[model samples]
Target: MAKKGHSEEQILRALRQAEGGTRVADICREHGISEATYYIWKKKYSGLGLSELRELRQLREENSKLKHLVADLSLDRHILQEIVQNKAVRPRHRRELGRWTQAVFALSTRRVSGLMMLNRATMNYQSRRDPQHALRTRMRELAASRVRFGYRRLTVMLRREGWKVNAKRIYRLYTEDGLAVRTKVRKKIARRARVPALRATRPNERWSMDFVAARLIDGRWFRVLTVVDQFTRECVLLLADSSLTGQKVASALSQVIAERGAPMSITVDNGIEFASKAMDAWAYQYGVQLNFIRPGRPVENGYIESFNGRLRDECLNVEVFFALIDVRDKLERWRRDYNQVRPHGALSDSAPAVFAAQWTDTAVPGPEPVPDRTGKPAAGNSLEILT
Candidate 1:
């Protein structure tokens, strides 16, 4: 007789009796099993009950059905292959079979000295005979003429020049010719002088101010005082001041505060106007942290530096400024457009407005505290600026 294994129902019944204080020896005798077998069953099925046994039975039936299905599939596959091989199928089916046979024969051959074999030499010769080398050369030259051009754009330019080539093929050649340029890696500079790291997560959390010098079209010299939002890349203030002193900067900052409220910190380079006691006192009075970039490192304040370049190129470069009002109007218009519509490729081609709009109040931890001038509790959302 074949050795009997414990059925799920039998194991569960034994476990139920064992849990009810039935002795293992008696339970084993009643089940007609040895003590070792009883222990093994207890270990395997002690926690299982009637519901679990029923589920196991269902799973076993499913597994048997799946096995039968797989066997039937294998048999059916063989029958289908036979039908496809038969001459009774469509002419297209026979043609496909013939192509497959040819491909297999070509792949299996060693082709010693090539007695008419489809080999690497034949493939290379066909590629050379395709008459697209001239078109490919033109595409490469066009891509080089532009500072940088992707294959799709190159394909467009080629088509405009009457090349009639596919964009996919151009892309293949573009990558194959090693034309891809890797993006420049940005490194975070470390603070060595024990200065506290300025934390700003929202617009106006921190402001950075700097002076950029440029000559008017008449060759008269002046300075551009630019104040930028450290978080949102917004230009908070801009002025075409002829002679900027510490008092002037403080006065401008005060005006900005009256308009847009005070920022938590102001980062600046070590210019004399920025380092003055008057500017420092004004910043301190408003409870604003003053930060200075490292000496001689212009890139330390890179955001403002980049902003200045764009301001010059887009606005200042296009006009002649005879008066401060003219400069002011152009600067204001450019700043508005820059913040609202100009796309920043560095920020994934998002405009500053779109980028700022994504920042929910939940993203910021809390507003900084500021005191009211009257020493009384201010209304909601107005921070108290402590001296």
Candidate 2:
């Protein structure tokens, strides 16, 4: 309701006139006020001068301001209490607090949001996203089967199975579902200056050979001879036996050579099997050079070393072999998967077999020869190595 516009001085003067024997009806008519309003004003502000009236008005305004301040402080205290009780940090949690505040404090959404320092939109949000029950179920299945696969690799696998998904989405769901794999932290080593190894420009241009060992469930140990093509990152051969001699290694190489042709050179560590006479004879027969790395320098044969590490990590470490037959069967299956299914980051996330099939062996020029001490080109082939 609109208030009457009688100034404090006017009201006080009217009351003084009434007190000084003026008729109430006459006073009301002069001021254009009802007699009831005059009496109410007199009852409220009787016996006061203009200065005292102004002071009372000022004090009333100050008291009203203090009441507003107290109400705001009470609201802030309630918000702080809610924050402490819930310890809400995430937006979802804060939204819950907003609901509680609205119910408890009888506040509107805007007021509660303002008090809680939360976004009104966030408080009103309801997720319309799919639960992805099928996707999550399939992802959990894959993770359970392949315990070492990370979200990135899992994304590749999901794509292969015709899922239209990306790694970022998969990673979000992967972490939410707690399917992340724990990785081991390796000790950092002091790097030293060393000669680089030769990079293979085409499949079968160069091969790396190495041996890995594993124990069967019966506690009987077996050795696996791993041969990898450096260019394609393909596992050329995986031979597992109770024991592998130099002759066995040579035989395995001969079989691989029969199928895929002989490489120009083979990089191998200075292991007994690789350095034996049988291996040398086999290399001589195939007219392939044997580039034996320095003793204890496994990095020189990095391709096979990396392949061996994966073999142990993904297959050997996870499986328990019962017999030589079981070992061979498991190794064969894993080798096929490694070549055809698993994604290689260095191969642009392509499988070894797929990358090899897509590769075009364009001729790249060889590196220039290193100069001698006299600044003249050396006579022999240049030493080009892979980093």
Position 12, candidate 2: lDDT: 83
Candidate 2 on 14-68: residue-level lDDT in tens? 9889889999999999989887788788877898888887787779778989999
Stretches of candidate 2 off by over 4 Å are 1-125, 360-387
Q: How high is each candidate's TM-score?
A: 0.46, 0.64
Inter-residue clash pairs, candidate 2? 197-385, 197-386
lDDT of 1 by residue, 1-387 (tens): 101565666777788898899998899899898888877766655676778766866786789899999986775455446445654343433434434443644422233112222343332332334646776677668766642446655665676568767878887677657776444477887856654455555667787789988776677788989998877787888878778899998998889887777776788999999999999888777767788889997766777898887777557766678777777787888788778765565655456766766763325333754465534332223322232
RMSD of 2: 12.6
At residue 209, candidate 2 shows an lDDT of 86
